[model samples]
Target: MADELTTRSALQLRDLVAHGEVSAEEVARAHLERVAATDDQLKAFVTVTDDAALAHARDIDRRRAAEEPVGALAGVPLALKDVLCTKGVRTTCGSRILQTYRPPYDAGVVERLRDADVVVLGKANCDEFAMGSSCENSAFFPTRNPWDLDRVPGGSSGGSVAAVAGFQAPLGVGTDTGGSIRQPAALCGLVGVKPTYGAVSRYGLIAFASSLDQAGPIARSVTDAAHLLAAIAGPDPRDSTSIPKPLPDVLAGLDDGVSGLRIGVVAEFMAEGMSDGVRAMVEASVERLAGLGAEIVEVSLPHAGYGLAAYYLIAPSEASSNLSRYDGVRYGLRVDGATTEAMMAATREAGFGSEVKRRIMIGTYALSAGYYDAYYAQAQRVRTLIARDFAAAFETCDVLVGPTSPTVAFPLGELTADPLAMYANDVYAVPASLAGLPAMSLPVGLGEAGMPVGFQIMAPLLRDDLMLRAARALEAEVGFDAMPRGPNALAGAAI
Candidate 1:
């Protein structure tokens, strides 16, 4: 029963809890035990709030007993990416500088989760300040992929997706700036959603790239991802960037078949450079979608090749500005120096990791006086072109399809020395983010190294429901089995 509960989808667990078939406490404890048993090997969690999770579970049980109205995800266990502030809980963003820091208020998503009665297992690990493509950049420790213990789980939401994929949690909340959520979800063989930018509130979320960063859901199935997304997505007064309109009903049309829907396959994404296995798997998935009655059309994003270069400049520039608040004089780490300037320098030098520092330097240089127009401004112009590309492509199709990542999860330390290789992992994913459109990664099949290959579905801004509908249709055709077979294979077997 415990194992069954651990492996169940969030919606399934919620239904079971709602029907009184299982108490919320029992469900929470089952997942807690799974985390305790598997997280040591997976290293997905930065903190495990077992006591708090149980306490929340007990409250949910009381509510159910009293016949009080419970939210859609009443008893679901969730893993929150460490980047979202969780009130009294430590929100590290996987950086040592804020290791001991705890926010006085919960992020908008956290508040929504609490309101929905979802029990947070703990804060999941991520890249330092949400900055890297691999979990190796985490200041605490790298989160290993559950499919192969020696390979990396993608980042900066590595721990969030890892937790769900490893059966430690039924669902997770992760932020996506440059495919942080989708890339990791792809590598982990889970469903990851990046809602249209500003559709989900960013208030209380530790800023990475303020304009680009948006929080969304990670789950084992499309239905589960839709349920979680509904709970946390909506307008928030605290976030100026948040859209004031009501969120579309993501689940209402989720099961709607994609009979006449046109799916645009980006011509450039299929050109070359990825492993043959990955390309073949993605093509097979596309064929499957076509087989399911959806029309497949070839669409070209002429400037797609420039997405990586533009994203690096825009995201890092925003990150550079947003991270400026962490000076020694403020709340995070402080190192003594002869003067204030030296102290701030020492603090940042000691607090940031190599990847974070690299981005900061590049961003600082891009935004510097003489180079601003040459770099930052030009990058912004390129961003506009990318968005325009998506706009033009959407006119010919209901949604776009592509491989989530060019390659599957690589072995640990494989790309550590090559930053460009790491950045290339987000090549296909960055274009949607740059356009502020809704996109999701659904596990379609296994590729090279027997790791998961993700099929990306993207919809125009505010049309998340359309994207999810297409994903659900494709998901049924793909029939992906997300069971991993590494150190936690026994745990999964028990499930």
Candidate 2:
């Protein structure tokens, strides 16, 4: 019973726990067992709060026994990407600098998840400071792709996706500044959502890019992602950037289906440079959606060509400013030196991974006074143009469709040598983030070398429900349930 329980979704687990088929304690214990057995090679977690998780589960059980009303996600387990602050837990963002740091308060989302009765299994690994496109930047260890250990798990949020794909957890939270969540979801063969900028609160979340960072969920299925989003999405007074609109029940209308949905396929995404297998998979997904009554039309975002340059300038610029707070002063791993500035610089140099340093330097250079107009301001103007492009495209369509990543999961070090190539992996995704639109990656097919490919769906801001409905529709049609299989305990396959 415990073994079978690990594969169930948060929604399914909730039902079982509510009906007494499985206790909240049993669900937590099973997930804890899976994490202990598999996380060594997967490196999915930086910290596992076994005692606290079980205690929370037991409290839920006690509440149920007392006949108190239980939340919709009661007793289900979820993994937090180490970027989110959790009180009393070491919330390292896969960086050595803050390995022993414990946040004083739970992030707004963490508090809400706790309120919803979701058990947090642990803090999952991520690219240090969420800088890299692959998980390799983690200072401790890289999170291996669940499909093939020898390959990379598309990242920044690689551990979150790997945790879900490897069945270590039913739900995982990730942030997408520029495809961090969706790219990993694409590679790991799972569902990941990046809500419109400010759709979810960023308070207590270690900032990546102030304007673009948004925390969301990675799950095995679209509905599971929706349920997790429903739990975490809402305005928070603590975060001024959080949208104040009431969050509609995302899971309420899942059965509405996707007939008559206007889903536009961006010509820019379908153009040359994409892998043949990825193209075929996306084309097949479009056809499948068309068969389901989606009006597939070609749309153009001409300025989309400039997205990479603009994102590179904008994201890093913001990252440089946001990361300045970690100067070894107020928190963990401080280094004393002859002078304060030297000490701070030395601490950062020794603490951050190479990717983090690269971005900070790039941002510092770009934001310098003489270069500001040439880079930062120009990038902002380009951002406006990109947002306008999406607006114009949305005028004729309800949603947009394309491949989430240009290619599937590449090998571990394939693009690490070329920073530009690494940034290009986010080609299809940055446009949506720049526009503050809701987007999701749905596993569509296997790409070259049989790695999972994701079909990205974009919706107008605040219309996450429409995008999710369409994705769930495509999910049913594609039926892409390609989990890695063998006698390797699923651990060896992922590690």
List model 1 lDDT by residue over 1-495, tens digit each.
Answer: 766798788888999999899999999989988888888889999999999999999999998899888877998999999999988888899998898998999999999999899999999999999998888999999998989878898998999989998988989999999999999999999999999999999999999998899999999999999989999999999999999997799989999889999999999989987788889989998999889899999999999899999999999998888888888786889999999999989999999999999999999999998999999899899989989999999999999998899999998899999999899999999999999999999999899878898989999999999999999998998889988965434256233
Q: Judge candidate 1 at residue 26 and give its lDDT.
A: 94
Candidate 2 lDDT by residue in tens digits, 1-495: 777777777789999999998899999998888888877767788888999999999999999999997777999998899999998889998998888999999999898899899999999889998988899999999888878777888899998888888888889999999999999999888999999889899999999899999999999899989989998999998999999886666887776777998889999999887899999999999999889998989999999999988999999999999889889899967877789998998889888888999999999999988999999999999999999999999999999999999888888888889988998999999999999999999999788887888999999999999999999988988887746643332643221
* Clash pairs detected, candidate 2: none
Give me candidate 1's TM-score against the actual structure.
Answer: 0.98
Give the best candidate by lDDT: 1
TM-score of 2: 0.97
Q: Candidate 2: minimum summed lDDT over ten consecutive residues — where?
A: 486-495
Candidate 2 global Cα RMSD: 1.7
> If scored against the real structure, what TM-score would every candidate get?
0.98, 0.97
**With candidate 1 superimposed using the best TM-score fit, by how many Å does residue 319's alpha carbon deviate from the native?**
1.1
